[model samples]
Target: MAVNLPLPIPENLTAVAGIELGHAEAGIRKADRKDLLVMKLAPTATVAGVFTKNRFCAAPVQLCKEHLAGLRPGAPIRALVVNTGNANAGTGESGLAKAKETCAALADLLGCAPTQILPFSTGVILEPLPVDRLVAGLPKAISNLKTDNWHNAALSIMTTDTQPKAASSKVTINGQTITLTGISKGAGMIKPNMATMLGFLATDAKVAQPVLDRLVKDVADRSFNCITIDGDTSTNDSFIVIATGTAAVEVNAIDTPEYKALFAAVQALAQALAQMIVRDGEGATKFITVTVEEGRNVEECRKIAYSIAHSPLVKTAFFASDPNLGRILAAIGYAGVDDLDVTQLNLYLDDVWVAKNGGRNPDYQEADGQRVMKQSEITIRVRLGRGDAVSTIWTCDLSHEYVTINADYRS
Candidate 1:
């Protein structure tokens, strides 16, 4: 079961204008399941994205980057094709060919150049994608393309997710209302540097390509990059933003108030989706948030936060509801901040101040820590009496089910 997360309601997922989605039962790995998705965009839409930083990035990621670089004023990405159940990574040149072939097939059907299409894949890494089945399903996906298919689109890209992750909201900027809808998927092999997740946000706002490009990165850092599942980054991680110029509001610069308003909406939706991944983390029974504050810089704070969030010992302690508070202090000490002053550190679990100035608080009791640890959701606050910087990372406790899931994944 996924911690405290609830299933997404389909009717509540509003569709962004100028984008149509369709899904098909490709049966790439499983029978009678949605394994293919197609997102058709308007000709006026502009696209931007941030991909995984892993050196062994998947073939589709490399192809998507190439297609994005080829964007120009007259030519824009017309469609995006996604497949689940096979990552299309580590097949060397053959994998690259298969990815391109998938795009070419979809492009032919859409009457657009192959370069105008972006392809994405997820699931069993190193295994060759069942491209034949995926290609055969494109017609079915295209035949059903509808603007209100966001719900089905979310379900098509899922792998280990217990439920489809999707959200929608409307923001008014200068009297013009912009609708943003997004979907994401991931349950394990998630970490920073794109977070091993696939996220796509589409808005009915007019945004210049350059500005949209920068906005995706900014939203990703504050959202997806602030989460970790197993401290492992997948090779196919990607977060893309699509702006269809159907709304009256036009944004071409980053310094305007309209830009800030748009950014807030995108960031909020992205964070909600990102946190869902952690909440549904493989074998996760507890959702944990680690916030590091009072650091000399944001980088150091994030480092400390990630260190504690990624500590298996600390996570296991939380899973067992054991008040093993020292594990957290140890994680912060070796967080690569070589000059960090341990004497100035503090730790807290919810409202219980467990440590004061790097030592166990005299007034603290083990029962108080246990009480917080037993909760379904927890927050671990770390204070470094250094400066005024803070960063928070979301994660989930490690459990026996996580090991079993991975061990039997290929079977």
Candidate 2:
């Protein structure tokens, strides 16, 4: 059961003007499943991406950075190949070779340079990518390419995700309507330093490559970077944004109205996708939002927020819907904010004041705390009487099913 997550409707997923997507049953790690996806981009399209900071990042991630660095102004990214169920990570030299081979295979079929193609993989770590099966399926994916295949593309990227995560929005900039649609897949090993899992967002709006690069980092900071699940970052996390340059409006200036509108739309879509990852977290039964405020700086607030969000004690209490709210305080105390003053802190579950001035509030009731905990969606707010900085993170409650899921993950 995936908390309150629901599959996205195919009809509502609009297609970007210069992007075509397709998927195939590659039989890479599983039988009768769509585990391969290929995306073809227009010659005018430009791409920007942010990858995981994990030291042991997948081979595809390293290759993606190298390939993106080789991107020049006129030579746009031609194709993107992705495979699920075998993260090309921890295989060392062999993994790098396989990732390059996958790119070369796709580039050969597309008649483009190997450096023009970006490769991505996700799933079990320390496993070799079955490049043979993946390469054999490229022709079928190419044959199936279509502009309206976003729904199937989303489904094809799944690893342990119970449902496909996707979102779409339209923004009018300078009288031109630009469509932004994206899909993300993540269920566990999530705690993204840059992005939780694999996310690809495409738009038809024209933007300069430099601006696009800056925009991706900004968008990720406010969206994908704000989410976490289980506090373990994956080796294959990637968030990529593509600008197809099909819209009539050109977003060259950050100060322009068009740029602001486009940025907001993209950030909103990314946030929606990030939240979906938490809602669909493996065996998750509750969605939690931890908000920390009045810190000396945004970084400190984020540390405190993550401390609470990542605490197994706090998450288990959320799972049981128990009023053992003190665990949240314990997390805050140990959050490494050396100067944090407990006497000036306040805690609330939704609107109910759970703690004040470093102790249980006199008016706080266990029933009220339990009431908020029982809800499928919950907000835990903490206010520190310091500065004005604040940070919020999305996560899910720890449950027995989470343990069971990971225990049998390889099976």
Candidate 3:
């Protein structure tokens, strides 16, 4: 059971023009399950991506970076190959060889250069990818490609996610309506400094490669990078954006109205996907948002927000619906802000003021805190009475099911 998360409604997903997706049942780690996904892009599509900062990133991640760098001005990405059940990380030379071979195989079938194909993998780390199974499954995925397969594509890339994560939106740019659709998969190991997760977004509006590169980083910083689960970064985190120049709209300048609308729509979709990941977190019962305001800088505010979000004590209190203000205060105090003034800080759970001036509020009531804590979703707001900086992080409450899920993950 996935806490309060609901299965995504398939009818709500809009298909992006110039993109086709398909899935196949590959026995990579399990038999008779859809574990492989292939996404085909139009030849005019330009792509950009952000990857995990973890030094032990998967072999596919390394290959994706290399391929993206080798892309020529006129040669755009043609295909994306994804597999679940084996992460293909920490397998040394063989893992790199397998990842490359997969790309070569995909490119051969699609009649494009190997660098035009991007390969992605997610599952257990430190495991060798079953290349034979993946290669054999490619033809079926390629043969079944269709423009309206976003729903199944979301399901195919999932590892432990209880439900598929997908979002879509349409915006008018230059008197033309452009469609944007995206899907993400993750359940745990989700502190992204790029998640053990994969996100793919595609838009039909025309965009330059350099602009796409900058847009991906900026959107990710405001979306995927603002979430945490268990405070562990994965070895296979990847978020990719594709612009298929199929629409009549062209966004060549970043300072134009078209760019702002496109950026806002994409960022909102990404944030929705990111929030879904936390809501479906393994053994999570409550979705939590930690907001830190009035700091000297955004970085310091983010530090304090994450400090509170990643605290096991605070998470446990959230799980139990216990108003343990001391734990939250402790996390904020040790958040490495040397100049923080305890007396000038305030804490609130939803609309109830729980703490003021480094202690409990005189008018605070336990019942009020309990009422907000009992909800499936809650927000923690902290005021620092400093500058105007603010930061918000989305997280989930820790529970025993989290331990159980990871303890027997391999079995």
Candidate 4:
């Protein structure tokens, strides 16, 4: 087991006083372990969410996609239900019914329509959920809800994750402080289609739903959707933003520089949380950054970057502290992009120029690459010698434990 490292929660998150957190140990996967989460948003709040693009997505994702439309400019979501240890995917019609039932139950508690509640699930796939356990745990969980239990809420929704990932940020909007708190869970099977993982971000800002939706989608495209781990998108991916309108800032629209500042803050929060997922990746000790620049187009740049990031050989090499540059070169060559010209390629390992003009630099040394790879984090720069388009992708090393864990995931 990896040693427990201190996960410092981000700064400036105490401003959102209206939001509440609730979780219960449903015994769905293991006895005496929490596995259910409910987040309460204030009425009159605004909400926006993005879901997975997979055709076989979970029932909750589909439900959320439809319900988020209801949380318009003045409307808001009442509750969010997240369950771990059972994805509730591939269950066909029954799963859809259960998702609706959970939403309806929460709506009843909150005295709102069923369409106002959103449900999300993660964990094992294809198994019918033990709805009894969830129901039995609901009342107790609701009673246990607290305002500042951010850490516990992050922990309760984890599956195969060594540590809980949570991030917070405080931004000043019209001189009023707004707090953003988010949590995510993905140790394996992560390749964000929307969230490409399970993440929820809540804030006390008063942004309109349309603005929030557009900003959330743009941020997700550059952050969560850009990263890869195993390149297998899950059936239960979700990312949501809830604005409680309690910040007391009457921010009008997204056209001004202040709006740009708030948007930047939200994007930063999403990127921070997304990086946490990779840092605590299943069996990962090193975080790798892959940058592909000078591509003919944005798509080609990302294609090459993801190909290198998702390459098992590249990941294992990173794990072993071996800077196998040849594997990276080969990955880019076969990224399904055209224009093969290694002579124009430039490479760097952790910012140290290593490859130049399709050949190893004279100053490159095995010790240099090994030293760079030994750091907890690394960056690999690949200049494709095409246009100026560039993209950065984040991932983690692949270790034997990764194989061991997935090999016996169901056993």
Candidate 5:
């Protein structure tokens, strides 16, 4: 079961002005299920994305990079198509050709060049994509496109997610209102090397391509990149940010106050969406926040935070509501901080001071630890006492159901 996660209210999911979304039941992997999504963009929109760093990336991921990299100032991305149930990864040349063919098919429907469309896929890897079914679903998806389909778009791209993840917020800058709405999906095979899931955020603000590109990477690093579930990155991890240029708030450079405001608003929404993915992680019962503070740099802080988050022993202990916190210390020790001084370290489980200065806090009790561990939401705070740097990562406890889910995933 998901931990403290709720379905997003459809009425609250405001739509961006320049993007229209539609979904279709393609039955790519299962019968009568929403498995395809098309997002048609206004001509004025500019798109930017960051994809998985896995060497064996999916064909669609490669195509997206090529399409975005090949963008001319006048010819921005026109549309995005996402299909669930089959990740076209590790299929070599033929898969690449099929992905290209899919793009061509969509471009023909939209009366645009094949390169103007960015393609995305997520699901079981190493299997040939059923391109004919996905292609056949395109017209139906495009036919139902609407500006207010963010909620259904969220559901259409889901693979292992227990529920759709979507969020919306509005931020005003210079008298112009910017609305940001986004959706993300992933339940397992997560640990974003670049990002182990799919995230699409669209805003009606006007932004230069260069600025949007920078924002996407920065937003992703602080959001999707700071999460882990099972520590396994996918071949099709992607996070895309779209700027429709419909609103009067124009940001052309990264140095402006407008850009700062936009980044904050987008970051907050992205964080919310990314956290939802962890909260709904496969069989997750607890949403865990691993925070490492007072580090020499952000890198070291993140390394230690990820170490704690990815520790199976610690995760299982969290699942069992067991305060076997020694596993946490062990994880921190092996986190590659060679010059770390354990004597100065302090650890807290929520409000309970479990460890003080590298030793068990005298006032700490087993009951106190268990109290926090048993909660659906828990925070693991580690004060490194090294410097001013801090980093936090969201994760979920490893449960037996997670194992069962994966063991029979393709069956």
Candidate 6:
């Protein structure tokens, strides 16, 4: 049995009515269980996605890219096939063929073009996918697709994840309301090159593919791209959004207040789901939020934030709940950003100021710092004393359990 992680569904998903979602127990990796999910989009749905930059990306990532490449401006994807327990990465040409076959199977079931179907997989690496298992599971998943199965769909994507992640939000535009729901899976290998994990956000709102594509990229940058777990990015990381246009109201650009609100709702949903991934990070006990402010630019701030997030010393210190300010400071010093000034730096733990001007604060107390560390969630704020730029990043603590889980993962 796998160790269960805290998987909670985010509120604000009940606003959309036309979108139907569901999952089936395919018994792909485990016997007598459901591990495959099928998502159907209403006819003529528009889709937008971001995929991993890893050269060794999984077969599904390649398949998704091919599907999205064929998408027109207004047409929507027909279906999505996702499975857990085998990444299907690095299996060479056979993996590619399996991915294409999976898409073809889904297309055949939905009576749509193969290029209109997308597939994603996450699990052990380098193993050839049990294509028979997935093929056998397709009919049940398609037959069982429904509107209220978001929870089941969320759980079907889990691999080593201890939790099922979901988020939802609603926005009103042109006197018409739209509902958005999302599900994601990730834990162990979670440093996103293009995307950090497997994410799917869907809405009944009608929007053009161009607008959806732009919005997905913007939101993904601020959410999925801002998180870290083990510092190793997966070959399977990808995020996708689908629009069914069931609401009957069409919007062209994100200029109006209503459109901005819609964008905010989507961004919130994505960020909430992304944070959930980190909170349930494999073997994670504490959640740390790193905020870098006063940098010369957003890129510089992100550099500082990611450096601290991916550092083993910083993560382990978080696990121990030790206020090891030195490790954080050191990480900032080596963040590889241009025009950094260490002399004018300031650091804070939660609301308590710890370091100032490259040294310990005169009023800093070890006991006070320890008090802050006792919480399962913590915030580290850094002021570079340069410009007004800011960036926020999330990560989980490093622990021996994380190593143990991965060391014996294949066994």
- Report clashes for each candidate as comma-separated counts: 0, 0, 0, 1, 0, 5
- Candidate 2: 10-residue stretch with minimal lDDT: 187-196
Task: Give me the displacement of residue 322 in model 4, in angstroms.
Answer: 2.0
| TM-score of each model, paired residue for residue | 0.99, 0.99, 0.99, 0.95, 0.99, 0.94
Q: Model 1, stretches more than 4 Å misplaced?
A: none
Cα lDDT, all candidates: 0.94, 0.92, 0.92, 0.82, 0.94, 0.83
Error of 4 at 307 (Å): 0.8
* Candidate 3: clashing residue pairs, number: 0
Off by over 4 Å in 2: none
lDDT for predicted candidate 3 compared with the true structure: 0.92
Tens-digit lDDT string for candidate 5 (1-411): 678888888999998999999999988999899999999999999999999999999999999999999999677799999999999999999989999999999999999999999999999999999999999999999999999999999999898889999999999899878999999999998896665589999999999999999999999999999999999988999999999999999999999999999999999999999999999899899999999999999999999999999999999999999999989999999999999999999999999999999989999999999999999999999999989999999999999999999999999
What is the TM-score (0 to 1) of candidate 6? 0.94
Candidate 2: residue 72 lDDT (0-100): 82
Root mean square deviation (Cα) for candidate 3: 0.9
True-structure Cα RMSD, model 4: 2.1
Q: Is candidate 4 or candidate 6 better by lDDT?
A: 6
Q: lDDT tens digits, residues 1-411, model 4?
A: 322345755343343567788899999887888899988778857778888888889988888988886555434688888899898999999999998988888877778888888899988889998887886777877887777878888888888888888878888866777788888877778885853478888877787767887878888898888777788888888888878888776445779766787788888988888887887777887888898889888899888898898889999998998878789888888998876588999889976888888888988888898899888879999998878898988888899888888998877
Per-residue C-alpha lDDT of model 3 across residues 1-411, encoded as one tens digit per residue:
665667878888998989999999989999988899999999989999999999998999999999999998767889999999999999899999999999999999999988899999999999889999999999999989999999999999989888899989999877899999999999899896967678999999999888899899999999999999899999999999999999998988788898899899899999989988999899999999999999999999999999999999999999999987789999999999999998999999999999998789999999999999999999999999999999999999999999999998999
User: Can you write out model 1's per-residue Cα lDDT over 31-110, one digit (the tens) per residue?
Assistant: 99998999999999999999999999999999999999888777789999999999998889999999999999999999
User: What is the lDDT, from 0 to 100, of the residue 353 in candidate 5?
Assistant: 98
